[model samples]
Target: MVFDFTISKQGNYAIISMNGNLIEKGQAIALLEKAEELTKEGCSQWIIDLEKLIYMNSSGLNTLIQLLTKARVAGGEAVLFNMNKKINELILITKLHTLFKVAGSKSEAVEILGL
Candidate 1:
């Protein structure tokens, strides 16, 4: 599938449904920018739903870190849900699984934020 992403909301959380491949800086920047913009608009929770993300690269990891930083500085946090095994493995390999709050579903992620 062609690269695509859609944004949805659950209460105060912004859920990004990512698809296709994320291999370049532009993709990374776009995703990061959206999260940052939402944070500036007072979104207190961010959820990245990776159930559909087929592939990702280092830039995608960079984007995630950027959002995590912003979320923490804003007194909020980015949660991840429905991560594919491949994607999950990447986090583990990088030892970043500890940095993220992983949940089984959108509701679970929202609950983690106490929303």
Candidate 2:
């Protein structure tokens, strides 16, 4: 399947739902562009819902790091929710799990970010 994303707003958070394999630079760039657009729209708090994502590569990891950095620069926070086991393992193996606030649900992610 082709990679794609959808963004929605919930209170102060921009919820990004991503799907398919995030292995290409173009896909990662698309996600970053969306986050940048949201940043310009005055949204700093973000929730990346990865429940539908089936594959991710190092580029995807970099995209997520860029998103988190952008949010921090905007004086907000970004958290992820519902990531699958393989993705979770990748994060942990890359030692990026410590950098992200992960949650089991949207509400839980919001609470973790205190947003």
Steric overlap count per candidate: 0, 0
For every model shown, what is its TM-score relative to the native structure? 0.90, 0.94
Error of 2 at 47 (Å): 0.8
lDDT per model vs. reference? 0.82, 0.89
Q: List the residue pairs that clash in candidate 1.
A: none
After superposing candidate 1, which stretches have Cα over 4 Å from the reference? none
**Residues 15-110 of candidate 2: C-alpha lDDT, one tens digit per residue:** 989999888887777678878888898998998999999989998898889999999998889898889999999988999989998899988988
- Please name the candidate that would achieve the greatest lDDT relative to the true structure: 2
| Candidate 2 deviant stretches above 4 angstroms | none
Error of 1 at 46 (Å): 1.0
State how far residue 85 of model 1 sits from its true place (Å): 1.2
